[model samples]
Target: MFRSMLVAVDGSDIGQKALEQGLAVARAMEIPVHVVHVIQTAAYPALALSDLPPPDIAQQALLDALYREAEEILAGAERTAAAAGVPVTTHKQLGHPGAEIIALARKVGAGLIVVGSHGKGKLGRLFLGSTSSYVVDHATSTVMVVRCEPGAS
Candidate 1:
């Protein structure tokens, strides 16, 4: 039985499905749910690439932007969970997606961690190694994954 649940959301339809799935479980258990979104710096695309080394300021700025994006994703998840009558908290993390998710799970003392099979990015999860798959294989806590077919909206 899960007393606290951690839902890792990334704004993809699959991620939305995972959020809904986690929300249902948390509501059934009448326990708190924590929604997390991570914008991994490595996952982010470089901007204005040039022969000249990019300024450290530019790299930091890009990271800042990614964190903002992460916040928006978590905010949307928070609103969705609240509307569904589930008490939820949101967090934004930066790092490898899998590592950040597992770290957040531990931080929240969540007994369960949930994630989607694929993200909304151009690179398919098979290539990037689905965050859900990684978490399920590596996380210390229990994990639940909701998979959506490729090309699903």
Candidate 2:
């Protein structure tokens, strides 16, 4: 029933699962899939307080590395979608992962959003927060959270 599907991949093993699942759904429904990899700036706090070099230089370096990783993640998603014979579009965003994903889903009119749960225990969630949880709570569209398989790391 979805017009389009948005698959959020963060390069984690569980994220890979979400991508595969999303592609399968897209293929079944004959709908295009949109893949988005958000570079969560807040995830890296060390760079914000680096005393080794100018803050701008350190920040830029971190941004560059994040973007490279994002590119690789998106590329892999695209290849997977292609092999599944599903049409796909990819987005690289810089911001909070959950917010960027929701915004892109709305912008692309994606009726379904597929994301992966880190399954970081309660303690981990308390300290690091969970992107999948945020998306499920804040997204207006349907969200499918792929749980991390036990021992899948």
Candidate 3:
């Protein structure tokens, strides 16, 4: 039923599953999908590293790396959609993962958002929250969470 779907990927195993699920939904609905990857900046407090000054060259290098990674992710998604015979578009954003995802969903006017519940670990998630949870809490659009079971090859 979704006309436009926004899928978020973080290059994690779980994120890959989310991509697969999102692609399936998009294909079934016969709607175009927009795949987005957010290059997270400063994920956690670097109490020790914070003492170091931000280097211009390092910042530029980080940006370049992020862009390259984003392009690869989008390319993979594009190939998946192509194989599924579904229409697809892509975007790459550099910001807080949660905020960027929500913002892009709104900007795209997507009817739904598909994201992974967590990016890493299996049982470790019992303590930490996931991007999917964050998006579900903050996003205005409907969110679909794909739970990628651990050890699923």
Candidate 4:
């Protein structure tokens, strides 16, 4: 029943499970899979210092590194999907991971959005935040959360 499936991957074990599930669903439905990795920008406080170069320069450098990492993550996802004989496209975005994934799902007209649950307990999530929680809460499209327990393949 899905026209397209969007998989949000981050190179984690849980993310790998999500990719596998997304690919499986896409393959069964004979639909295309869109793999997306978001480069979350580090939050830095604005500093007013005329003597030194702008902080944006450093931020840009960090972003470049993150972009490279994202590309690597996407490449691995592509390979997995390819090995599974699933049609796949990859995208790299810069912003909040949950928001970007939702936006891309909308843009790509994805019938399903597949994501991995980190399995962080409630207190941990309360302090560290959770992307899957955000996506589940904010996304309009159907979402499937694949939960991979620690030490389980």
Model 2 Cα lDDT, one tens digit per residue, 1-153: 889999999888899899999898888899988999998867787543435365577668878888899999999988888888887899999778999999999999999999999788789888989998899999999999999877665
The candidate scoring highest on lDDT is: 2
Q: 3 or 4, which is superior by lDDT?
A: 4
* Tens-digit lDDT track of model 1 for 63-98: 677777787888888888989999888888766889
Which candidate number maximizes TM-score?
Answer: 2
Q: What is the lDDT of residue 117 in candidate 1?
A: 77
Listed per model in order, the count of residue pairs whose N, CA or C atoms clash below 3 Å is 0, 0, 0, 0
Give one digit per residue, the lDDT tens place, for model 4 in 70-104: 99999999899889999689999877789999999
Candidate 2 Cα outliers beyond 4 Å, as residue runs: 45-55
TM per candidate:
0.82, 0.89, 0.81, 0.88
> In order, what lDDT does every prediction score?
0.82, 0.89, 0.79, 0.86
Model 4: ten consecutive residues of lowest lDDT: 42-51
Query: Which TM-score value belongs to model 1?
Result: 0.82
Each candidate's root-mean-square deviation in Å? 4.6, 3.2, 3.9, 3.9
